[model samples]
Target: MTQALTLARPYARAAFALSREGGRTAAWSQALAFASRVAADPQAQALLGHPLLNPADAVGLLAPDGADEAFTRFLGLLADNRRLVLLPEITGQFEELRAEAERVVKAKVTAASELPSAELDAIKAALKKRFGREVEIETAVDASLIGGAVIDAGDVVIDGSLKGKLERLQSTLSQ
Candidate 1:
């Protein structure tokens, strides 16, 4: 992971610089998503390990149609260097770039079950009201929670799940 990040940092920085200048940060996200799909393909993975696949051929294979030319050239560099496997790192870096530019934080919330639309909206509204910035949410289900939800956003975690309460009760009883 460290090596991948190290390898990806330069490419990500270059892409970020170019996209920011054009005010096309979302383009970086889309391009990185496309690159991620290309990197994850079985044939692409195999090709990454092949000694015979030159950079230009690899770039031709990985570059999807409709991609921005600048982004394509950026991806070409990675392909040429056989560093496509570090795509996840590049995505993470690009996300950071977008976040820094937008001043919005992305958050993930895991609950025992699916949250209703109303509840999710309320949460987002409350977060926005408190934080004074747009909050981007990603949610998932974790059945082990039994009930309630655990919200993690940036440095804050609000653990309101039944499982957490139960553990706290157990500790109190034992004490």
Candidate 2:
């Protein structure tokens, strides 16, 4: 994993520079997502792992079709260098660049059940007030939580779930 990430870093930095220059950061994000999905296919995985498939053939298999020339070229370069397996890391770096430029933070919320719009609105309002930034929230349902919700954004995690509270109480009593 470390080796893959190290190999992916330079390519990601180059792509980030191009996207920034072309004012197509969002486009790059979409392109990276599509490329990553394509590269994640079982056939692609097999081809990537096989020592018999040379760099050129690997690139041909990975490159995107018409209408996405620049992105296709980027994928081709990665594949030709036997780096197609690093798509996940490349995607991560691209997202990091986009997030930094957009000043956007992604907040993930997991609740015992789905949150109502009103409750989500309240949470959003409080998060906005606390962080003083634009936040894009993604919510999920986790029945194991039992009740309440957990919010994780950047380095801060506000866990206010009944399951978490009970676990803490259990620990305390045990201690």
Candidate 3:
């Protein structure tokens, strides 16, 4: 994973730069996401690795329909370099770069049960105030949480779940 990220970093940066220049970060994001999905497919893996596979065909296989020339060219470059298999890593890093550039905070909230819209909105408002930036949240239900929720916001993780509290209490008592 370390090596993958290392190899993919430059390509991701290049892709992000291209998107920024073209003012099509959203388009690039979608196209790269689609290409990553295509490249990660089992059958596509076999095809991409085949010695007979050429760069143009590889680009065609990976590029989404209606992709812009710039993005298609980007895919061609990746294909030419035999780096199509790194699409997933590149896409992930590209998203990180995009998020940082846009100053958007992506977070996940896992709770014991489904949260009401009002509660979710309150959480979003709090996070926005805390981060002083636009917060994009995704929510999940985890019955094992017992009660409350866990907020994972990149560098910050807030474990407010009863299960987490009980575990901490137990550890402190044992210590």
Query: Where is model 1 poorest over a 10-residue stretch in terms of lDDT?
Result: 58-67
Clashing pairs in 1: none
Candidate 1 lands at a TM-score of 0.89
For candidate 2, the per-residue lDDT at 61 reads 66
C-alpha RMSD values across all candidates: 1.8, 2.1, 0.7
For each of the candidates, give the backbone clash count.
0, 0, 0
Candidate 3 lDDT over 131-155, as tens digits, reads 9989999999999999999999999
Could you estimate the TM-score for every candidate? 0.89, 0.87, 0.98
* TM-score pick, better of 1 and 3: 3
> Which candidate's TM-score is highest?
3
Query: Model 1: per-residue lDDT, tens digit, 12-115?
Result: 88889988887778867887877788788888789876888777777677666776778778877887677788887888888887787798877788999999
The TM-score of candidate 3 is 0.98
Residue-level lDDT for 76 in candidate 1: 76
How do the candidates rank by lDDT, highest first? 3, 1, 2
Error of 1 at 30 (Å): 0.8
